[model samples]
Target: MSNKSSLNLEAINDFIVNWLKSYAENAKVKGFVVGISGGIDSALTSTLCAQTGFPTLCVEMPIHQAESHVNRANEHIDQLKARFSNVFNERVDLTPVFEMFKNQVSTSDNEAVLNLTLANTRARLRMTTLYYLGGLHGFLVVGTGNKIEDFGVGFYTKYGDGGVDISPIADLMKSEVRQLAAYLQVPDSILKAKPTDGLFGDDRSDEDQLGASYDELEWAMLEVEKGKKPEDFEGRKAEVLKIYKRLNSSNQHKMQAIPVCLLPDKLKLL
Candidate 1:
């Protein structure tokens, strides 16, 4: 497996920036909009978008977001705006909107299901806000998902964070993301902070929810690609493999293309 030390950070950065610029120009859009989550992924994404020289709008949609998250997000946005002439930012507090949505929906007796549903709701609401802003400004909604979250474990909401016009860093692993982030001068605060989706209004790290670190998950993903099975491993390795497999299986719907019910030719003719 290729390690982060072997990555050509400068070349990778140039390629992604050029790609973002070319896609936006070909699509005939004004610029790009990204939801800044104060995490490494979003920081790197917004930075790449800004480097494209297009108008990159970094939006903070906080719905009961933790103070650390808000601070890091603001810090990163501020740094980006100061560094790049094309960078812009917006703060849209969605706490009240989320509360109103909860009131409109029926309550669930299952605590786990209810919490999960609300977390997804937060993601969807942020997605809606991003699209609304994008539509108004002719900006493409840029996604902040990394390779592991988007493909390996499907750690993102279906249409929420998954809904994006373009993904610049989806091809890079989590370790590679941190490498590029440091190369691009992302804030030290975010670099050191724990990764979180920030949907549950708490400080629970992504590792806490995934049951394995990105390093473990990446190893398991690579092993699976090499046709390895759970029985081939033992101890902590086996546990991590099972965790990776469980998430990969359950989240295939998110990773794969949406299903379309196609009618037969005869039925269509009839």
Candidate 2:
């Protein structure tokens, strides 16, 4: 929770730009590969990548994407391309790929699980495509996740949206991301648009799925970080704490590295 008085947009931008430059130099990658879903997070990230004077490949991989979502993504990419010489935009429709995948693993009498599986598959497919492009051109995949999604509640799918070589905005909360987006002159329509993962065909918003707005979730997470209990909320204690706990517990795995088993010399002695 960065205070307004302490938040310096220019400094943040400068730092991220330098970070990207240094990271690419160290990795020996040519540029950044990003999946642009028209969300402000992607918009801000790609914009920052472009500012590094390195190629920023913005791929719009629409698998049953809503028309509005596609339009917004194109609009943002157009803005980026117009402003930056290093910006590149491409569209790859993955509908057939998804349908083929859905047909392969789907079983009868589990429509709900199958539906969720399909959504996650969409994310992984996009990830695969981004990595393919990244490998082809020696670019690192630049993730579009923010603090609340990547760390707070872990809203991203593991090895799906969670798979990336670098995460520039993963520490900025959703509200702070909106502030940065506004400062970066992101289009007003995208800045005000409801946040969605754009994975579902019906286009459910992130808040609709999370059971609470990002502002509420961010505040609750901060309170929990400050050693405040649910009882501190008084009126909304039960409601707020429930959402916070459910999200953190369920999505914890996404935030953690993969677990590995280890054997010790003491075990050999035994």
Task: Note the residue pairs that clash in candidate 1.
Answer: none
Cα lDDT tens digits for candidate 1, 8-88: 889999999999999999999999999999999999999999999999999999999999999999999999999999999
* CA lDDT scores, all candidates in order: 0.93, 0.88
- Residue-level lDDT of model 2, residues 1-270, one tens digit each, is 233335799999999999999999998889998999988999999999999999999999999999988888999999999999899988989999988887787465788887787789899999999999999999999998998888888898889989999999988988888888899999987998999988878869998888888888888788888888776666665577678878898988888878878788799894
Q: After superposition, how far is residue 61 of candidate 2 from its true place, in Å?
A: 0.2
TM-score for each model: 0.98, 0.95
Give me the runs in candidate 1 sitting further than 4 Å from their true place: 1-5
- Predicted model with the maximum TM-score: 1
Query: Given candidate 1, what's the lDDT at residue 3?
Result: 38
Cα RMSD to the true fold for all candidates: 1.2, 1.9
